[model samples]
Target: MGTMGMQGPQPLPGISHVIAVGSGKGGVGKTTVAVNLAVALGKLGYRVGLIDADIYGPNVPTMLGVTRQPNITDNSMMEPILSHGVKFISVGLISPGDKPMVMRGPMLHQIIRQFLQQVLWGELDFLIVDLPPGTGDVVISLVQTVPLTGAVVVSTGSSVALQDARKALEMFHQVKVEVIGLVENMSQMVLPDGTVLDVFGAGGTERTAAQFGLEFLGSVDLNPSVREGGDRGMPAALAGPESNLGKPFFEIAHRVVSRAIEISRSESDVLEIS
Candidate 1:
């Protein structure tokens, strides 16, 4: 089997910018960040597509409340399920419940390629790929297949999380993919009695971003409503911009867009020169 390393990067049709939301390890709320960013971008009037590329643990379908099977077109392309003004596809939608996927690297490559090529994602301004945590086969396959505009690394405020987050950042750099910025999730929390708590510690993620000269996108507080919204099949970002729970996501989305545009322009310049 030919790896993405063997072939030139292939751009997805009808998608302008491809953003991968990933983490160095699991349980960092990477999927949640990916979902919220997509939703927030949609709310800002950008036509967006979201791919739940976390094949092993595809919870995006459940998180977005899209349990229905996608429609197949006459051309045999799978239509993306639309929700909250964004189009999305997840392996969870077609898979038979939480049964584990036991595929090797080759199988993983084919699936990722099919998701990009066979899905009829029609004229998307942005395609947000929710990748599995870690620098694994899937991540390598994706970066090789698509000329990603950039990547967003997500991490919690803990030291362990930062260590993994650093690994993720280094992986992106090694692959020549632009690290758009870092998003620190579950950074802070407030008690019912107005007492604030730094449950996992604070500012480490931002400091790391600064150390690496990357933009510190921002942090999202550890809000109960974030989890509650996910359980309700409604990400906090879709709760509208005025919502306290949703505001941080919107802020992050704005930074992501700005960075993506900057990267695109830089690429265009180099192409023109070459």
Candidate 2:
């Protein structure tokens, strides 16, 4: 995808693809999807990194079970913490505990830029940014800071969630970022006795994706094990791709990699023509 901002987006050195995982509104399990996606990509043997850009509610460290602060290199760059085979950095690392980050727009922009440029991420096949929900300052700051390969929007199957999800898609479109696809999280719940229940109503997210002409990556069930795993700081994706809990994330990761490659190739073609 083409870069944003007047000065244009700067590419991160040694990073092949940078993907942002976002949603229009909160409470849709966006961070869960992002964390699992990064872990799944790593499980698939790709080097991965994750950035918890949700400044106000930096839940990635909790979900990843990381509480250690990053080490500062001799050159002053923060070294990302390694967890579950993926290197990552989050505001939670710097300021741990229940205290909130009370800051203004300029401070938020500076923090985002620092996370993008000041971290020694080394080489990564994919750097997944878990953005705060909504079409707000963090999203704008991200695009202005670095060139994104594409974005993956997460939403539940609820119609109300889809309304905000549409807004997120529109925001990405307006910013000239290629939306890689839409992933429907907590789409359904499998009850005992071989029955399926539509917890948030069925097929709404996929329908929304079709309406926007974007790929419907896949659906994830609302399993209690998934919740328990997240709470226990072990993502369900650690079960590996062949397991039931991890298969969906692996499937989504596969589609995401494919879409990113397509976007990169298309951008190359545009560059050639220009």
Give candidate 2 misplaced runs (Cα > 4 Å).
1-6
* CA deviation > 4 Å runs, candidate 1: 1-7
Q: How many backbone clashes does candidate 1 have?
A: 0
Question: What's the true lDDT of residue 242 in model 1?
Answer: 88
Of the candidates shown, which would achieve the greatest TM-score relative to the real structure?
2
lDDT of 2 by residue, 1-274 (tens): 3455357678999999999999987989999999999999999999999999887689888788887899998998999999999899998887788999787999889988999899999999999999989988888898888999999999998989999999999999989889999999998998888799989977899999998889999989999888888888899999999999999999999999999999999999999999
Worst 10 residues of 1 by lDDT: 1-10
Model 1, position 24: C-alpha lDDT score: 89
Model 2 clashing residue pairs (backbone): none
Per-residue lDDT for 119-184 in model 1, tens only?
Answer: 989899999999888887777888878999999999998999999999999888988889999999
